[model samples]
Target: MAFTETTARLTDQGVMAMLTSAVQAAGASGQPQCIVIVDGSGVVLASFRMTGSRYLSLKSATAKARTAASIGAPTHTLPDHAKAALAAATGGDVTGLKGGLPIRSGGVLLGGIGVGSGSGEQDETVARAALAAIGADDI
Candidate 1:
């Protein structure tokens, strides 16, 4: 697989618009949030941190996005799908912690989105809303 640099790299503006819409929705709920999007190689594509969002939210969201993109699995699917082989292969860093989801388009994996802030359930809700806004299927 080839690695692509996402720092200042171009991406689909429509996807970004969808992500921002989701973040705004979460904020409208009166909660701060950290949102991160990663490409298939686990490269940070886009990131946003709402005002008053917890500092730790940045790292947590990054972890969730990376986990999903690296494994082609949703973070919520981890606990039940824990396999020794996967752990060993991933060096034991996979977290099925409930707010990470892969972004799929037309059956093709585009990237992954992870959200943190508020709470775990809230994070998932925000991310799911973003994906829905883009009509992206979750992996």
Candidate 2:
């Protein structure tokens, strides 16, 4: 008898499929967007932004993805908790913004995704789509 151990990855094709869907959805609402995907160590693996996407979205998306990776929690969850924990630390980098999500496959932390340029809710929708395309569990 033998047991097989499979490897997992956040493939470029998969990531693209997800981002494209998000872009389509966001664009439908006439909103440009920036999307980011990073590994567990806060390394960026993929990113894209529509021409009209707000310039700030690039940095925000990157930051959100990094935060999710570094904190090992969903982007949506950390902000409120960070607020209580940081209190005075709110102004700088770690703002309680949404649209970041960690990528986990078979209980392993693969990476994370972040979106911006639209409303927080819209950004989150994009992130969820990306996660799904990459075959990850949990939002």
Candidate 3:
């Protein structure tokens, strides 16, 4: 059977806006954070790390973003079994961490967002705030 696939992508403006929102959220929460946005194919679009955020969090943030984009879903919402399977399959490049979420709008997938350098809940919160800024939080 022949099939066609289509996907949405966030513009550079959108990426910057999300990053700004995440930084603002992290500041409000008094937590340093690293934020990363990836395209639908898991390519880094933009990233930022607040002062005092751990250097290692850069990798974590990218992994989370890539995981979400690859699966077209929020990393935190994946079933444990699915998480385990994906981790095994991706050799750890993809994670089931709560900081990652697929960026969707009007039911169209538009890449992903991830936050790091905080607790799981905090990271997720920051990521959500980023999505909200882009008006893509409904997903």
Q: Which candidate's TM-score is highest?
A: 3
Clashing pairs in 3: none
Per-residue C-alpha lDDT of model 2 across residues 2-113, encoded as one tens digit per residue = 6986666677776677778767777877878898888777778888888899988898888788777767677768646555455256443444578877788777877777
What TM-score would candidate 2 get against the native? 0.79
For model 3, residues 1-139, the per-residue Cα lDDT tens digits are 7598665678889999998899999999999999999998888999898999998999889989998888888888888878788878878788888899999988788898888999999999999999999899575
**Rank by TM-score, descending?**
3, 2, 1
Give the range where candidate 3 is weakest over 10 consecutive residues by summed lDDT.
1-10
Over the full model, what C-alpha lDDT does candidate 2 score relative to the true structure?
Answer: 0.76
Candidate 2's displacement at residue 52, Å, is 1.6
Model 2 / residue 39 / CA error / Å: 1.3
Candidate 3: where is the Cα deviation over 4 Å? Answer: 1-7, 82-85
Q: Candidate 1, TM-score vs. the true structure?
A: 0.78
Tens digit per residue, CA lDDT, model 1, 21-47: 768778788888889888877888888
Task: In angstroms, give how far residue 64 of model 3 lies from its true place.
Answer: 0.7
- Per-candidate TM-score against the hidden true structure: 0.78, 0.79, 0.89
Candidate 1 vs candidate 2, lDDT winner: 1
Write down the worst ten-residue block by lDDT for model 1: 5-14
Which candidate has the highest lDDT of all? 3
Model 2 per-residue lDDT at 68: 77
Off by over 4 Å in 2: 1-8, 79-81, 84-93
